[model samples]
Target: MAHEDASFTDISIQAASSHQVWDPFVRLFHWAIAGLFVANAFFTSPKHDLHHWIGYTIAALVGARILWGLIGTRHARFSDFLPSVSGALNQLRDMATGRRHAHIGHSPLGALMIYNLLVTLLVIAGSGWLMTTDAYWGVKWPKDLHEIAVNWAELSVAAHIVAVIVESLRLRVNLARAMITGKKDIRRDSR
Candidate 1:
């Protein structure tokens, strides 16, 4: 009995030390979307052809990501980290209580942020496209919507960055590194 207990603990420790979570497709999609958003937001002017092309590209990438979410690797799938109110509350409780529980994939709040950003980006793309059409040319709502959504997305991105840093410190996991490398190195002592 004692030997069995010790062996089980050893295996648990080893498994918790490190593991692959994000697959290559997920990592690529994440960085691509990030870079494209930065370009469209800062470098490309709306009147330029490059801006329109980047918007189209962002829309296509979002489409691909939706499909991938439906049929992708375990951690990449939507089912792996569905957003939940209870889960978020529980995480908050854990934080308040100083309880350490590191998620191998997206945390509940993280999942919510992911969904929020995806939808916001889609709105920005759709509105931008509408403004280009003959029927909606010179229309104000779509253009207004596009601007509003972009502002929301920018705020969301800032919040996401802060949350990632805070969670990484709390969990003692290098989350930004994990996204880049497709692996998370969780300490064995973490729960």
Candidate 2:
């Protein structure tokens, strides 16, 4: 915050003032996608109607989220979170030493993970949707594509967990709980 970096300074100030970051719709979409993904993974059978329904649910959630990012609350917007590689490295340097970089939205690493999860979810839903169509029925490649995308989604989920843990430890805040409540506990800058 003491430095002259425009992005860092602006985001730091926003973080200092951010009362609530994630909006209700964004939060709803996120948890909805998560729940349906879990249900799809466990309860799915090859030809079962539930699998198709779950896939459609995930797709719809992703579509809504994509729209939300354009007009959502401050931190929920993609413009607020996505960062360049150089900016991320600078943030990483501060993180390495346990410096308090009050990021308003997703951290550099988390921004990447957010993008990753969304992209993966989109691919998963797209391929799964394709598999349900008459042209793709009993097709080897579309099913295979769906599987790969799902695997990537699993990886992204794991990455999300690790990122939450890292940010929690670094910021000394319970981030998972924050995601649910859409609030972060941080001291108001007294400076």
Index of the highest-lDDT prediction? 1
lDDT for predicted candidate 2 compared with the true structure: 0.73
After superposition, the stretches of candidate 1 with alpha carbons farther than 4 Å from their true spots are 1-16
Give candidate 1's TM-score: 0.90
TM-scores for the candidates: 0.90, 0.85
- Tens-digit lDDT string for candidate 2 (1-191): 54333443233422334347667887788788888988898778857988888888888888888888888777777777765576677777878876766665566767777788888888888887888889998889988988898888888898788878887776655677778899766544343
**Deviating ranges (above 4 Å) for candidate 2:** 1-18, 187-191
Estimate every model's Cα lDDT from 0 to 1: 0.83, 0.73
lDDT of 2 at 50: 85
